[model samples]
Target: MSDAQTDPPRQRRERKQNADKRRRQVLDATYRSIVSNGLQRTTLATVAAEAGLSQGVAVFYFKSKKGLLSEALRDLYLIYEAHWQEAVEAAGDDPAAQLVALVKADFDPKICNPAILSVWFAFWGEQKFTPQYGEITREFDDNRQRAIQGICARMLPDDPEHAADVADWVDTLTDGYWQNLHLFPASYSNRRACNSTLRALAALMPEYRDQLTPAD
Candidate 1:
């Protein structure tokens, strides 16, 4: 019958949608579990329970606890990448503007939070066991440094060597601030951290100092 024929296709479509939904659900649950329980205590059982899914289903989706946590890290990395990419585009062609935008993107409340920061630190700690990368490839950190270096070179055409050094400082400073957030969540404020970064950057890139550190 027509109803029977259409029902199978509808069910197939639904099955695909459900599969995607369940995968996302599990990853989100895994993130929450890691945030709440810490990587040491988080397990397949806990994530599955948080997701309201069976351990068997979690295993089928991700294959193992490692797989589950890997996917969660991947999700966070993509969000981080997209935020900065969009920030750069919005800042247009000015290297100084773009650099500032990219730096500020890290402190955006949407992605920068205690929960997410904790998850990042968790994967970092497990770097010995896992590949320790998400959507960001092994070269992403290098690429970002290169991008910042290039920007500084453009801004200060005379001192390319110092520009590269400044890029390294920026990269390390950014990482340190994020680690601070993870390490001292109670005392750290994203706004305060970002302001400190902006001040340091403004000092480092003096040509763009006033512009980078706008009044008020």
Candidate 2:
């Protein structure tokens, strides 16, 4: 194909790339706005300004404020899903190590830093906003819980019921630790938050705590 024939495709590709870039720019701005202004006050105009674009651009992509917020929530959930999936895969075949990797992934500052957690709590505190968001977490957590439960069962073959309970306990403790991070970030840095979860995991399964904790 000559340049004349190929130029149109190139132009189309550039437009698509710019559109994707803008979409992410707007979403990131939305998150920053929510963090700075609180979700209730984060207007589309504010998001556009934060993104260094006009409100018309944001409207062009998301159509409305709800759409932008919904996409942000979906992106957040996908990020968390990827982190844990990679962690589990990297743990090789040891169920104990895999479980520990899963726990550590939850508190990884790259994905679950205080700023990010605050953004999540903003969406979580507003039930009205949640309905607008997709159900990305439902199946994600279900599959994760099942994976952990199966790992626990394997580790404690003699006591399957206790293993099941251990899985549930770990998730509950994880939630508590997350809540602590959101509710008390000054006192509970991501490191501290993760350690709290690890400590609880230790108390629950002492046999694998050493494997879970890294050597200094």
Candidate 3:
């Protein structure tokens, strides 16, 4: 192949990798900035400093604080969704196992890291500044709720309505634990949280008690 043809494809790949790297760097810095300074206090300059990149570069990529925050929120939601989805898939075909995996995934270190969790709550707590935050989070919640509801339906073949109720309870318990883990790290244990969630699952669906026991 001609150098021009071969070089263009290689250069394009390199450029894409570099662009992706820079975007991830900024997004990570955004998470750290929000965790450290709170969402309202986070700015392009703060993120740039955290990223060791110039504010101009941050601006070039994300345009403004609003844009940056929206992207960061979306990125974090996608990461969370991906983790649980992967966990559920790994749990095989048993609906009970899938439900257990879903609860455990919420506390998985990859998605439950304090810094990332704080960034989520920061965006969640801010109701007025950006509607994008609400939109992104609602999408995440809706999808996760559907996944849980589906699993509950499979587990509770006789009563579909009760399945939904159990799903709601499961979501509420996991969310409460997440808040506890974020707000009261002094007394919170991830293993305990997972155990508590599994216990609640067992109570909700006693028939599946054997399957709901915490694996850890």
Using lDDT as the measure, the top candidate is 3
Q: How big is the positional error of residue 119 in model 1, measured in Å on the Cα after superposition?
A: 0.6
lDDT of 2: 0.83
Q: Give model 1's TM-score versus the native structure.
A: 0.86
What is the TM-score of each predicted model, taking all chains together?
A: 0.86, 0.86, 0.94
lDDT of 3 by residue, 1-216 (tens): 775466878797897899899999999999989888998899999999999999998998999999999998889888889999999999999999999888889888877868877887888888566778888888889999999999999999899999989999998998899899999988997889989999988988899999997766
Report per-prediction Cα RMSD to one decimal: 3.6, 3.2, 2.7
Tens digits of per-residue lDDT, candidate 1, 41-159, equal: 99999999999999998999989876777777777777778788899889999988888888888889887888888888888777766664533445466666677888778877898
Q: Tens-digit lDDT track for model 2 on 1-216?
A: 776466788797887899999999999999999999999899899999999999999999989988888788888777788889899899999988888788889888888777888898888788545655436556567877888898899888888988999999888988888888888777787777677777777777778778766543
Any residue pairs clashing in model 2, and if so which?
none
Candidates 1 and 3 compared: the better one by lDDT is 3
Candidates in descending lDDT order: 3, 2, 1
Q: Against the hidden true structure, what lDDT does model 3 obtain?
A: 0.89
lDDT score for residue 4 of model 2 = 44
